[model samples]
Target: MIDKLAWIRIENGAILTARSHNRDTYYIPGGKREPGESDHEALLREIKEELSVDLILETVHLVGQFEAQAHGKPAGTLVRMRCYAADYHGQLAPAAEIEEMVWLTYADRAKVSAVAQLIFDSIHQAGLLK
Candidate 1:
């Protein structure tokens, strides 16, 4: 299993998604935790690196956890994603390995990873995504 962290930023019923350089599918922002790092530490570090934004520490909140077969991996490989929602400071821009950033709604589900599809399903069910 690949354990990962993801940030959920919703605006106008769409969720923020990122496509890394040379990658075809979009994914929720954030990444794996570094050694000995807490969730907040890793999430803050990742969002800063990937989205060029500072996630307000006090505003971070768990959204949900999700799991699915890993995309572009051998069958049976799974990704376990822990999701969070937070307010941030700074304009959202693609950075680090991220090649592009886009706001995606439920109608754009096919453009993301399996775990991200699950995220779409969840938020859509909650009536947060159009």
Candidate 2:
């Protein structure tokens, strides 16, 4: 199993997603946490490194945790994604290894990672995605 953290940013019925360099599928922003780091710390650091944005510490909240077959990994490999929603400051832009950033709706689910597909379903069911 691969454990990861992700940021959920929905605006106007679309969610923010990123595709890293050399990767074909997009993933929700945020990444794995470093040792001894709290969820907020890791999330803050990852988002800054990946998107060059600062998450408002007080606005961060857990959205949900989801699991699915790991995309591009062994057939049975599972990925557990802990997702959070937060307000941020600064312009969103591709940074670090991210090659592209896009806003995706429910109809575009197939373009993202397996874990992200589950996230889309949850968001859509909650009436957040178009």
Give the count of colliding residue pairs in each prediction. Answer: 0, 0
- Worst 10 contiguous positions by lDDT, candidate 2: 109-118
Task: Give lDDT for model 1.
Answer: 0.97
Per-candidate TM-scores read: 0.99, 0.98
Query: How much lDDT does each candidate structure score?
Result: 0.97, 0.95
**Top lDDT prediction, candidate number:** 1
Per-residue CA lDDT of candidate 1, range 86-123, in tens?
Answer: 99999989998999999999999999999999999999
For 1-130, candidate 2 gives per-residue lDDT tens digits of 8889999999999999999999899999989989999999999999999999999999999999999999889899999999999999999999999999999999999999888999999999999999
Clashing pairs in 2: none
Give the winner by TM-score. 1
Provide the RMSD of all predictions against the true structure, rounded to 1 decimal: 0.5, 0.6
